[model samples]
Target: MAIPSKTIKVFEELLESPQNRLVEQAVESGRIPIGYSCSFVPEALLMADKLFPLRLHAPGLAGTELADNYLSCFVCSYTRGLLEFAMDGRYDLLKGWVFVPSCAHMQRLYDNLEYLQKPDFNHILDVPRKVNNDTLLWMTEELQMLADKLAHHFGADMSDVSLRKAMEQWNDFASVVQSIGDLRKKPNPPINGAEFHQIVMASLASPKDLILPYILDFKKEIEQREGIKNSRARLMLVGGHLHDPEFIRVIESQGCVVVADRFCTGTIPGFKTIDINNDSPYKILAEYTFAKTLCPRMMEDFDRRLNTIIDTVKEYNADGVVLEIIKFCDLWGVDAMPLVSALRDNGIPVLRLEREYCLGGEGQLRTRVQAFIESMGK
Candidate 1:
């Protein structure tokens, strides 16, 4: 299915442009632009502060020599790119930085930012490495502290009324992504794999207020259109630190329809929401985020994470699954083989690809994905 020009334009301006339209629009409107590294940073909290919760990304970064001065070359390329951008004055527009943990590189990135050049505001959030009732209490305390810090730092609204309103808007944002994501499950999805991925990338790259209504409108467009997809097999993508359009395009170019995905950048924690009915939204946010985030950083949680992949395979009716991993990214790296084995054990074909942090490695990936799809012979 061809993407609507209007929707395509939305991403082209955000993803392909030299400057971030969302950040530009936020700055021009006199709103604070708060950049964050991990999904654990609550958008609802940022929106409550009237700040644009810009998910920090190093789109189209050419090289990482500058960052290599401070970070070892062994780190994930995505982290290297982020540090390079920061040192090169790329994040000068951001007023604050919020970092949460799932990997060691990000933790060091915050330290490097503090040493080289620090933003006006800096916050490091703590999430438990385990899942239990005690985790809820710990996260509650941490979120409450974060709320207080943000209120003091930005001098913006943190009232119950403001918090509730932010949750409503965030829930609406989730609804729009969920509606579009649901389309991928159709036997002949109305949207192509790369097209839907662009939609997901646009959500993180742009302001939620602008992207929300735009996608809600686009949802109606896809609903009324007829799909024309005839692929060799159904594929599901699962991994981390991936936002490259070429990654999916190359796979699709090989006669595979990417039916579903689970990743930090794609959709996992990104699709989830807290209980808005709770009187204390902070506690709700803490509990929901702690429970739902299934990164490999959370040790001994492999069963839950594997179950999620299996469930996605079943739910999307995927014929095979691909796990995309960035080399040396300890967070997802360790799980690649286990996931491949577990999924294959369940009678699902699995392919694991170790890729670059950026878009340079698609030639090799295309060959493998093509072979994988051809083997299915659907």
Candidate 2:
């Protein structure tokens, strides 16, 4: 499934023009529009119902004032930026919003949008924590309930055939993404970290049909390029909102390849797939919510998180870890010391970089990352 070059060009163009008009067209054409926070939401069901499932990225408007009313002054910049975008009516095209209870801040944001601001259609999906039979049954029911709601709201019945079709399409997208991830496992990965980040970000922002082809093409491009002759130290990136290509570029150029990660924008979203056959989607969601690897702000499981990191480092044979702490992101920042301690205990070095979701600090960040990588050589 090599993606074509033409497909890559089209995807790039679509990203450049992420306008309301495009989303509006999808809605006006009788497709229901739904927005989701995390990538765990199943796109197949949405497609089956003739709806547009859009991953909410930037709201396209400033959220400073709106966010100030709800969140604290020291919250993650990504949260504030998104709130500002929503406040400015950039998400006017959204008929419904799906909030996967990943973090407290995101849950709070969902509450505000659904209850306070009042979007046309709103649903808070409760993701389960642990993966088990009980959780699967519960999740299936939740998906059905969501399907029923959409059927009623859109004045269309959701058929079994459509559901199955949607499931297949969603699965196809997942498979493509998984292939991309597998590529990273290779010793001389054809794709660079920055390019890979861009591809993933593009997939998040657009539909699978639009992004899949581009990814395939990008994979082909990588295969054609000369592979890395000397392997660099492997590093696992941990943090939230790492959609910036420049951040990846800075880190990769410092002689370290990000082989694995647990970031909000990275592995976390792809780790779980929605089981549409659950007896209760809400309960399944709830289980995922509770079982999810809690961040510093969410739970007091630093040891557990540390163990998870250690396991990933060992699994990926990583030489070190990089924690991209968003500036003033209380959760990650607060957990920094313990996370560092845990990594050090396992004889794996770690690097902490604070960022504001901008490229302005790249020069200094690169220097620090280079130093970290240099130490790995010794």
Candidate 3:
């Protein structure tokens, strides 16, 4: 289906810069832009009154000359690119930052950011390496403390009423995104991987209220449009921190339909609804944050993570899983070893690729994907 030009333009404008048109509008309306990375950060807390969470990304960074002085050459480009962006004043719109020490590279990025920008609010909410009753309680307490700090620093409304309202607002947004995501499950989907990637990336980078209407309109348009025809194999992309939709285009150009994704910025668990029940918003948020599909850093959750992928393959009817990791990402690099072996043990086809933050090597990636699809046919 040809996407409506208006909807495409909205998505494109949002991604064109860290401070997009909607972000400028939101800031002008007196909303504070709080920055965050990692899916582990509970977005609802950042969504409190007068504040919005801006997921930090550098989509088309040309070079990391600035970040290279602070970080080693071996750090993944994702982290380096973000640091470079901050150093270049590209993230000046953000008033604060919440970071999680998900990996050493990220920790270093946080360190550089703190030393360099030292924004109005600089905090890190340490995540538990293992999940348990004690850890859950610890997480709840941490979130409560975070709420208190945000209130103290930014005068944000961290009251239970405000937090609950924020979660509801987030839930509403997630439902709309999930509805659009479910389209890919059809035999022939109205949206392709690149188009869906653009939508998801734009939604994450902009304020929910500002982008929700455009998303709703786009959803309606695509619902009545014809499904894309003539695809080769169905594939699932699993990886970390891929903000470039052009990479998805390269894969799809090889004739495979990327029907599902389990990546950091992509949908799956990130877009899932926050099931609220009869509990304090903090506890609920803690549980929801802890229970997301595990990143490779969670050493004890390997079995569950592996099962999730295997189950996801069947759930999505994917012909194979494409496990792409950023070069020098220690956690995913190490995790990919066992993941490849285990998925193959479970009789699932897997293609593992190493890529950088910025999109490159299209000819090589296309060649590999084409070969993989051909092998799937045989």
Strongest candidate by lDDT: 3
Candidate RMSDs in order: 1.6, 4.5, 1.3
Worst 10 residues of 1 by lDDT: 10-19
lDDT of 3 by residue, 9-97 (tens): 67877898888999999999999998888998888878989999988989789999999999999999999999999999898889898
Per-candidate TM equals: 0.96, 0.79, 0.97
Instruction: Give per-residue lDDT, candidate 1, residue 317.
Output: 86
* Per-residue alpha-carbon lDDT of candidate 1 for residues 1-378, written as tens digits (9 for 90 to 100): 555546666775677632377768777888887888777777777888577687788878889999999999898888898899888888788888889876888898988888888667888988788877788789878888888888888887888788888888888888778877888788888877787788788777677887776787778788876764677888888888777776788888887788786887676546776577755888877876766567888877899989988898888889998888888888787788777888888898988888877777667888898888777776
Q: How does each model score on lDDT?
A: 0.80, 0.66, 0.88
Worst 10 residues of 3 by lDDT: 1-10
Residue 75, model 3: lDDT of 92
Deviating ranges (above 4 Å) for candidate 3: 1-6
